[model samples]
Target: MEEVSTKPSGYKEYVAGLLAGVATVIVGHPFDTVKVKLQKHSTEVEGIKYRNGLHCTVRILATERVRRLYKGATSSFIGVAFESSLVFGIYSHTKNGPQPQVIIPSAAFGGAIISFVLCPSELVKHACNKAELLQCRMQVQGADLIVTGMFPGGSTALLRESVGNAVFFSLNTDSSDPHNLTDVGIGILTGGLGGVAFWSAVLPLDVAKTVIQTAPDKSCQRNPFQIYRRTGVRGCYAGLGPTIVRAFPANAAAIVTWKLAMKLLGIKNE
Candidate 1:
């Protein structure tokens, strides 16, 4: 069989990506909140905040209510929506162009764009997640809990996105040929694997970001190296379980939605 063009018009891909992003945030925000909490938990603290993902989910629900799990939802929704749009839009544009072997490069470029948005958005999301906890622990009433700093971990984010998208788009491209299964099924499987790869590659950086973002004060200036030294290898992967669990369904849905939206818009593989 001849190679099929997975290209879609830029506008179509952007719109599809936005839909995918919304679906991803709605499905994955709670798991993501828990993952951040788990990653940022310090052994130095008097007591552990959560024993595991299950424990974390239970506690957040019981004490903070379901809404707490969605702290910073608006920021994440907006950020991921744009981020996904950029990723898909760029990928579609580049793949359709005359450039040879463009998939990897397109993915890498898309990743770079994603990093810019993810840094600030992630910072806000993490701060929002811990705002109540911080307020309760610090006993500061009506305090402005926004954390601000120069963006760190852009390189790692780039690596994660480039590598993960490479895998995702490559797999997605290969799987687009419909033998018996629907496009959605192929998208789901490939997307889930891509999500797993993305998280696995970036979990360490994520842990570092969590630590820095959730630091008790501006004086708590610890880099990724410091965090590694303090927590060791295991610390870098504190919430791997929840992240992987969250990755499959959320990303699968996002990818499926993206592909389906493209189909609905009459963008066909040729």
Candidate 2:
């Protein structure tokens, strides 16, 4: 078992989180492409029909080849990098309070905080989603407001993130005591489960967020409930298949990378 020699406290979480975000984007972007496709068009009666995540993956590979699946990868990489760093950093930082007690609340607080961050990044990512290949999503946290109109799906983002983070952190692990998690394997399992819980809880909100953010026209209906009424219950979970599948590996890889990065940086998870 590899042990992290240096247990320095302060900036390590953000650094480790940075690495974790990179891993997440690399491992999960293809699935995410499938997910976004499904979210955007799965409910449609006429158009490219993606029966499921696998079908979508196959179709994209067949038509556009692998590159098509990673169309927005560049922008996704940058946005996810900042979003993920803040996710772990803020959540972990707030978790400094009494263990177990503050875990979920801290996660929610962190989620709420980063909701502001992710809204614009996500907007840019999705706004240019169907546009030219690999649009520059380098709009940092602050510049996003003016660059992208006032966040289109701000409320939905907040709901998904706050609730999602609470569920994700709660299931992540009982890691308050290091002894509880035997090793990295356990951490990976718990972390993956956490990710699953997060998506499962908030996927509907995600579907709404995607639709709202990617709306071509502002006059288009913005209400999630209205969408649900129009599309029905099944439509709300349009991309559930890909999201569930991506949840495990993407987040498992993230947790493992986070731990490994911490080891390399001479620190430990907060």
Q: Considering only N, C-alpha and C atoms within 3 Å, which residue pairs clash in candidate 1?
A: none
Q: Per-residue CA lDDT of candidate 1, range 1-270, in tens?
A: 433335555488788788989999998999888887777773434465777889888988998999999997997788788888888877766675333366667777777777777776666556666786455424542334333353545555566567667766655664253333675577778889878887887788778877875666555655677878889999999878877999988988787777777666666532
TM-score of each: 0.70, 0.74
Give lDDT tens digits, candidate 2, residues 1-270: 666543336777788788889999898899878887877776755668788778888988998999998886987788887788888877766675435678888888889989998887777666565653223222333455475565878988998999998888777644333333466777778778888989888988888888887765567688888878888878888867667899998988787777677667655454
Query: Ten consecutive residues with minimal summed lDDT in candidate 2?
Result: 132-141
214, model 1: CA deviation in Å?
A: 4.5
For each of the candidates, give the backbone clash count: 0, 0
Provide the overall lDDT of each model, using Cα atoms, as 2-decimal numbers.
0.72, 0.76
Number of the top-ranking candidate, with TM-score as the measure: 2
Error of 2 at 184 (Å): 2.6
- Candidate 2 scores a C-alpha RMSD against the true structure in Å of 6.0
Model 2 lDDT at residue 151: 80
What lDDT does model 1 reach?
A: 0.72
Model 1: residues with Cα > 4 Å off, grouped in runs: 1-8, 33-72, 97-100, 129-148, 175-183, 212-230
